[model samples]
Target: MRVAILAVQGAFIEHRKKLESLGAECIELRKKEDLEQPFDGLILPGGESTVQGKLLRELEMYDSLKEKIESGMPVLATCAGLILLAEHLSNDEHVYFGTLPVTVRRNAYGRQLGSFHTDAEVKGIGEVPMTFIRAPYIETADEQVQVLAHVDDRIVAVQYGAQIGLSFHPELDADSRIHEKFLGLIADCIKNNNCRKN
Candidate 1:
């Protein structure tokens, strides 16, 4: 299975390594053309939301990405990546990738000092440690979005259909279960699509 990590900026390198450890072909997305369909799945890594927004505008992947998600492509977004995927971002125009049905509060956990580690019982991964660095706190999620993990009574990880978003950095942890779970979902979707084609 081929997996692409949006490497415009952020912890994509770590995600690539983690996914590679799972025996998947990992690709680091560097240009708009990299967003094309047929890749098994995509990963939007943690980074500064505003910066990513500017990059998306420059690269011209914003609309294409929207279309991909709408077509049921499986994705996993982390940190500011989560903020971008949110439908109602608190930052207005700064919000670029509004693909998921939710609002996001950027830097809700504060600055770098807010960077801390905590443990949460992820539904598929069990109790895994999460590293939150200036993470966006989820304000609301659609009914279809399943709350996966929480931090201090706030939703930190959520899953809506084939997409998953996290308010913390799963790549920072030693655990690869989260990425494995996402890859599993991607594989299942690809298999179903192939069956339909046949």
Candidate 2:
């Protein structure tokens, strides 16, 4: 399977390494033309949500990428990527894609010093390593959203349809379970003919 990593800004290279290690052909999406490439799934890596959002629009990649996500493209969104997908931001006014039906609080865990790591139960995945840096936890989710994992009683992970949004940076961890789960989602979408083609 082939996957597209939003490389406009963020820790996208880490995601590429993880997915490529899983035997998936990976492409970096740094420009609007990159969207023309055929891919089974998309990965939005951890980074500054504001900067990424701005770059997406400036590069004219915002609408196309958002349309893909809304149209059932399997997406694995980490950290700021999760923020981009959220429908509501409790602490911030700007909303990016707003494809995931959940509310998130930007930098809910404080600043860089607040960043930490741990192993937690990620629903179907079981205990997996999670690293958070200026993470944003889910404040509330729509009824259809599946609660996946939590840390310190805060909602840190959730799934809605083909989209999986996480507050922690699974790419930073050695464990490949999360990325594997994302790839599995892509496979399922392809099998069901729900995944979009180029």
Candidate 3:
């Protein structure tokens, strides 16, 4: 399987290392031309959402990536990446892709000092390490969005269609189950002919 990582900003290299370790060819998408490459899935890593969003637009890669997500392309988004996919931000007005039918509160855990680590039961994957760094949690979701995991009674992981959104950094942990689950999603989409091109 081949996956594209949004490398314009954020902790993308770690994601690349994880996916590559799982036998997937990884591509760093830094320019519009990079988006033209054939990739079975996409990863939006944790970082400053505002800066990532701004860079995506400034670099002319936003619209195409959004189109792919809307067209059912498999995506694994973490932290600020979740903010990019959220349809609404309860605390912030800016919305990036608006592909995931959920509402998120940016920096809901407070500041960088609010960051913490915990082991949680993620629906299909049991008890995996979750690292939250200035993360955002889902406040509400549409009827179709599936709640995958929760921390401290707050929604932290969700799946809507082919998109998997997480409030914590699974990539930062040693466990690769989350990334494996995402690859499985991509494989399923391809096998079922549900994977679409933008």
Give TM per candidate.
0.92, 0.98, 0.97
Between candidates 2 and 3, the one scoring higher on TM-score is 2
Tell me the spans in candidate 1 whose CA falls farther than 4 Å from its real position.
91-93, 111-113, 194-198
In Å, residue 170's CA in model 2 sits off its true spot by 0.6
Candidate 1 vs candidate 3: the TM-score winner is 3
lDDT of 3 by residue, 26-51 (tens): 99999999987888899999999999
Model 3 pairs in collision: none
Relative to the true structure, candidate 1 has a C-alpha RMSD (angstroms) of 2.5
Candidate 2 collision pairs: none
lDDT tens digits, residues 4-36, model 2? 999989899999988999999999999989999
Q: Which stretches of candidate 2 lie over 4 Å from their true place?
A: none
Question: What's the distance in Å from true for residue 66, model 1?
Answer: 1.4
lDDT score at residue 77, model 3, on the 0-100 scale: 98
* Candidate 1 per-residue lDDT over residues 137-158, each given as its tens digit: 8888889889998878899999
